[model samples]
Target: MSRLVACLVLLALPALAAEPAPRRPVHTYSIVARDPVTGELGVAVQSHWFSVGATVPWAEAGVGAVATQSFVDPSYGRLGLEMMRAGRSAQESLAGLLAADGAPGVRQVAMVDAQGRVAAHTGDRCIVAAGHVVGEGFSVQANMMERDTVWPAMAKAFREAKGDLAERMLAALEAAEAQGGDIRGRQSAALVVVSAKSTGRPWVDRRFDLRVDDHAQPLVELRRLLTLQRAYNAMNEGDLALERKDTDGALAAYGAAEKLVPDNAEMVFWHAISLVGVGRVDEAVPLLQRTYKADPRWRELVLRLPRAGLLPDDPKLLARLTGAKAVKK
Candidate 1:
């Protein structure tokens, strides 16, 4: 029953279970946060309900992040972001929504706006082992959990953890699980992060949006997806470097992407191509060989690159790269 002072009043209200129960009782643990250094806003959640990712997490760049669960009402996420987008703070937006709701006592929701103001609510009618903790730039909340320690452990982890918004939020989720997470056990999870400022393009502003729709171990799969996202992020940086004609910078970025997923053929092939384009054929050979051995289609793709003006038209170089001809002294 531990909770922030603001939520005490809500807890004192009569239980709303007299009304019909929400069809989707998405009881879960979640956190909404704004990164102090990057100004990025994000929300992460794990639940026993199926596909919690689809309903629990919502965020808008330069506005706020929201997590709505327990007896979930998805309108909280949409309307909360709408309010924050219209200049309302997270606290103001959540308070207004709760005030107008017919059954606020059954909902669990948290929000963190771009400016880092955070607020949360855990309705009195929520199941046992339920509570919330609001910190400087974040709010950690949980309902129907294995223990009351879940949200506090989440808050502590997010406070002391290092890294960007996505990583820190993930740390909070991991901590919740370490405290015996959802009472019914894990099913689905989601993590979403948006830029500090909007780019006017919705797709571009969504930095890291990932979900594990259904998994026996949702948190573990979510972390793996995050790693893959980072690798692809490095690849994009490499592409940007190439556009800038910074060959050395491109190589460094590509090398990083390759190291992140050494077994990924796409990353290995691109790193090899970048190295060869820089006239570091010797360094490129091993990487090319690795990809070619894994799938002969990569060698075929290399052969087509010359005709597309992406590679030199020299037959000798192509032969040597494909391992058909020996490297010259």
Candidate 2:
């Protein structure tokens, strides 16, 4: 009986020693910065886990961007934006918030203002190899890096890269990866860029908002999407020119956009509008008819246009433009 008990005790001891401690909640860490020339704010992050976009990356059109990660308290994102809006400097805002948090040691964050003031924090009790670096108008922070060089590499990329705000942010992500990112591997990535001018229109105010929810190669796919976004912008410019009756300018812009994305329905629809603006009604009729047939709501809009003074007063011209029966309002 004593020998059997001794063997059982030996087996139990090894099992207990091998067991890992129960994991506490995870917090995210990231870099937030502003562009001096454009005043565009951005945030970039990498995590050992999946789909970090939900907990990280927050921004309002006119307010500063925020990245709340690493044993995270999500409230920091909202509170930081409020603090910045309330006239607190980035440094003061971060310091005040972290000082009040019970788990400061596990949180990491960085913020930059439109005036180029920057602030960053990396809690002492954070996982090993976590640190942050801040420079003129930029900040880079990382946790679970393979070495201390991750943040410095990111800082260098942000300063040296020549591109728009989104490109600069992407460079930082690439730099972190080159310096041994997440100490695990990549899963997801996201980028968002908002114009300094709100224009009171949310859809048009945001310049670039792209996400790679789950991918083996997120950054590469993100670059491709940005290219498509530029093409769409061209299409919008063409539509605006058409509205002003600048037929030549509208054609040039639409041609450039269509060359980039030829199959897009909006591009095709707007190009047809440009043709019509220049009195090419015969050419416009077929394209508009195709679009109307594909979407019945568009047909309804066409029927309502005569009453709104958008369509010609002549019944014959209206009938020729829309083959379907027109109901006089």
TM-scores, one per candidate: 0.91, 0.72
Tens-digit lDDT string for candidate 1 (1-329): 11332343243223323333355899999999998888998999999888898989999999999999988988788778877887778887788778757888999999999999999999999998999999999999999999999999999999999988899999999999999998999999999999999999978888899999989899999999998999998898888887787777878888998999899998998888889889999989899999988999998898888765567888889888898764322
* Whole-model lDDT per candidate: 0.87, 0.70
TM-score, cand. 2 vs. native = 0.72
Model 2: per-residue Cα lDDT over 1-329, one tens digit each? 23433343344344434552223334333567787888877776656556777667776666677776667655666667766666666776677667556577888777765466788888898777888888887778887777788888888988899898888888888888887777767777777777665678878767877777787877777677777787788877886775786777887787677677666656666666566657788887887777766775665666565565445566666666667566453
Which candidate's lDDT is highest? 1
Candidate 2 ranges beyond 4 A from true positions: 1-29, 259-329
Clashes of each: 0, 6
Give the lDDT of residue 311 in candidate 2. Answer: 56
CA RMSD of all predictions: 5.9, 12.6
